[model samples]
Target chain A: MTGDQFPLWAAIAVSVLLVAGSLLMLAGCIGMVRFRSFYQRIHAPTLGTSFGTIFILAGSVVYFTVTQLRPAVHEVLIFVFVSVTTPVTLMLLARAALYRDRIERVQDVPASKDPLDNAEMQTSKKPS
Target chain B: MSRVLPYPLLTLSLLIMWLLLQQSASPGHILLGLAIALLASRAMAALQPEKPRVIRFLPIFRLAGRAVVDIMASNIAVSKLILNPNSDMTKSGFLTVPLELKHRFGLAILSCIVTATPGSAWLEYHPEESEVLIHVLDIENDQEWIDTLKYRYETLLLEIFG
Candidate 1:
């Protein structure tokens, strides 16, 4: 079945929603490029994950459900998976960035305690 | 059960994805999906990644709900800043917050949550020190960001996966 078979009003509504969502995603991509710092740019992808994926998935569900005359909730899984995974990737990237900064001792970053300093306390032998 | 579905969750999700994409509930389609899922799980099993033990699942739902709402709110706020060029809403900077939870799986999940949200991005982490560095879109107050991440996310993640 094609989208044309669906009611014209429904098609228009879905198309509008999809377009708006895509625009949001496009804006996010622009933000990535316009932002100067790596950390600053990291916020761009969330535009894609937060509402970008949701809108696209929503459109898919609406189209499928309307055309087939059956409810389609399974697409919720895509939303679930993407929302969950995007954060994980971002966190790792952030941590990696921080590691690089600390090792280099970049100025302005707050000082952190050395967890390794306590390792000798747990050891059986005394320090030389 | 273990032999048949090396990764039960993965297999089930694969099967669901297959059905959703195919939009078919026929017996033949189900068989095909099962076969694909089985093969996929086998491939995944070969990776030998450390198995994540979920001590509490309910907290995960709460965490997810909180994340969704925050992301949405941040998205709106960031978009407004982007739309207005004249405004001085562009003070972006990195932040470092100390962490207590050390589990790799939990840390990974935390990273994703931070990155997925707008207005802030996880930039780096130090395993030895257990500290996370993040970039905030508009850094009006630094302590606010640190406290939010620690109290809002770290607290719940510790309950769920720790």
Candidate 2:
């Protein structure tokens, strides 16, 4: 809120981070539309979620830390949470997509293999 | 110590997180954070997920630095692909790579690393076959991606976890 009080170096850093973060998110959106297939499109949003969120939140952390004259590191909670949760959600979505593709008899995706049988076969083969 | 806190590191981190969120180091807040952290660790102990033993701290730092660099590089690369007028020049496809790292904790970290990188996404992992299916936005060469994963992240993860 107090732009005048914000130091020049912190201001430049925050601005750079904000610009870079927004650009990454923009690229992600562009990829989501540009990619041909569902699988290809899925990789797009991670750009925004991973480093995009990181940069924006990091800028916030720096800005707040400078302005507040305290650590103000709570922004890290969002960073940690986003970094952890994004992969989980993406993995689940990917699995669901794979399942749907299998049901529909999609051509590109490999056929679903039973996880238990696969494990057993591996273990049995290792003994030889 | 074990009885009081099942996961000392987890409890300590949670306490730090709580204090950060509160933005104060008052005695009351510290006590409350300690209580919550203890309770959360106890709950975690009940779940009993594989406790990842980090034998080396240096590898963790190295991995973190490597990840940051990779993410930054990929972000630029992917941005270029997206912004290019002739995007069709780039090929996007799936590639499955066999993995030697079998530790669940290590695999999870690997998944996060792969998925977090802009151009790659972890599609499916077969625990039994020790293979991971990843979709690459630009699949110029499959072996290169495999080598990058194996050398860049997996080796560091093996060192940290083992």
DockQ of each: 0.39, 0.57
TM-score of each: 0.77, 0.89
Candidate 1 has an lDDT of 0.78
Off by over 4 Å in 2: A3-5, A69-71, A115-128
| Residue ranges of candidate 1 with Cα displaced over 4 Å | A1-12, A69-128
Which candidate number would show the highest lDDT if scored against the true structure? 2
RMSD of 2: 5.7
Q: Please provide, for model 1 over B1-162, each residue's C-alpha lDDT reduced to its tens digit, 9 standing for 90 to 100.
A: 878778999998899888887878799989999999999999998887788998999999888898889888888888777666675645887677899988888887777777777887776577877887677887887888888788988899899876
Model 2 over residues A1-128: C-alpha lDDT tens digits? 77587788989999999998988899899888888788888888988988789889888888888888567576778888998898889888988887667655667787656766445544443221
Q: What DockQ class does candidate 2 belong to? A: medium
Best by DockQ: 2
Error of 1 at B85 (Å): 1.4
